[model samples]
Target: MAHFPVNHPARPLYRVLSGLIGLYILVFGVYGVAETWGDGLFSREDTSALGLRTNLAFSLVSVIFGAFLIIGASRRGNLGHYMNLTAGAVFLVTGILMMSVLQTQVNILNFSMATVIVSLLFGLILLATGLYDKVGTEEHAEEERRRREHPIAEAHR
Candidate 1:
């Protein structure tokens, strides 16, 4: 026989974090797009030094990826959850590296600090949500075991 289960405590927190990250991605991507549009693609230094075209190409790609994250989180699908989390970590690392490079090129303390703060917040959220899920799963399993062992006493009318 098949049985239905109640929501695990971890599930809600995971979904909430997933949704927040999705929104974060979309907002950041949009800002990037606007900045690139006005600034003529990549920063002059980035383009000239690394031969990297940080143009509309990157913004468009980021927008598309962000959209996917939003849809996945909205649907509460398996793949979307994992992808969003992975993307969060990637964003944190990439932001740090980019900020480090940019700091050397430009004396913008505020900009570098903002980037680091955003990355730290996003990474921390992802890490917290992941650990919550793991702990919640184990707790749920233990509760189930206790229920099974003390069936009648734990059962509600």
Candidate 2:
């Protein structure tokens, strides 16, 4: 059996961010479904067009991904290893689509603001997670080097 290093303090931070993402997704899905229902079963202009289907699909996918993130974080799984990057890419693509292709003729502010905020959060998470992983790798490498070079100085029975 191989022993891995102790969990880094940054691990908790990663988990917290994952939880936040989960909350965002869950809330978005719940709100989206409720709004559609509250609006007389998708009778609005947006719904009648195609926004309803797109929003619902996006919300469902988000909910599923968010749940996985939360579960993986709780179990200390390696989900965080790629989740941040994947999420960031997803947000970037969606943001571009929302700003360009899905731009509404009226009430553009709200749409732009929401997309921008989500995109920025994704970017931040990606950067932070990537940096943490790099730092941990460097620390582990340094530890290994020290162990190899100063073995006799800290000899064990």
Candidate 3:
């Protein structure tokens, strides 16, 4: 729960991307739930976002996960980055698995080609963002320390 400065060089990118991803996912889940709110959780016939059969219970889980991402993103700390990375990995793996097992398995969590591709791409974005913009990493800490210890001399132009 360390507080990173919002003005940190990479903070804006981190916040924007995290927030966007979270918002999209949250909306996606909400849509799915609304689509099947009265169908008793998992419908045997309701297809939803990414071709998955929408289930109230599963949709709630998605919404919670999305909220987690959004909450983490609101922070200036590294928590959001970590969450993005983990969530992305999950989405990527699950999407691929779903695609592979599409025909053989009767799953409420389903997939199409678009779903697989989107998940893979989103996962990559999350991983890249997390890897690139961490605040307390050794390199960033070192750079900060240097800035504090050795202020740049003003030009006397």
Tell me, by lDDT, which candidate is best: 3
Q: Which ten residues in a row have the lowest lDDT in candidate 2?
A: 41-50
Per-residue alpha-carbon lDDT of model 2 for 1-157, expressed as tens digits? 7333334456678667766776666666666655454443313235311132324445455567667556544554455645655665666666665666444553222244455566566657754553343224557767755666798865772
TM-score of each: 0.56, 0.58, 0.72
lDDT of 1: 0.55
Against the true structure, whose TM-score is highest?
3
Compared to the true structure, candidate 3 yields what TM-score? 0.72
Predicted candidate 1 versus true structure: per-residue lDDT over 27-125, tens digit per residue? 666766665666544344232101222444455555776676667556543454455557667767766766777546442222345555665677667
Whole-model Cα lDDT of every candidate shown, in order: 0.55, 0.53, 0.68
State the displacement of the C-alpha of residue 101, model 3, in Å, after optimal TM-score superposition: 1.2
Residue 58's lDDT in candidate 3:
60
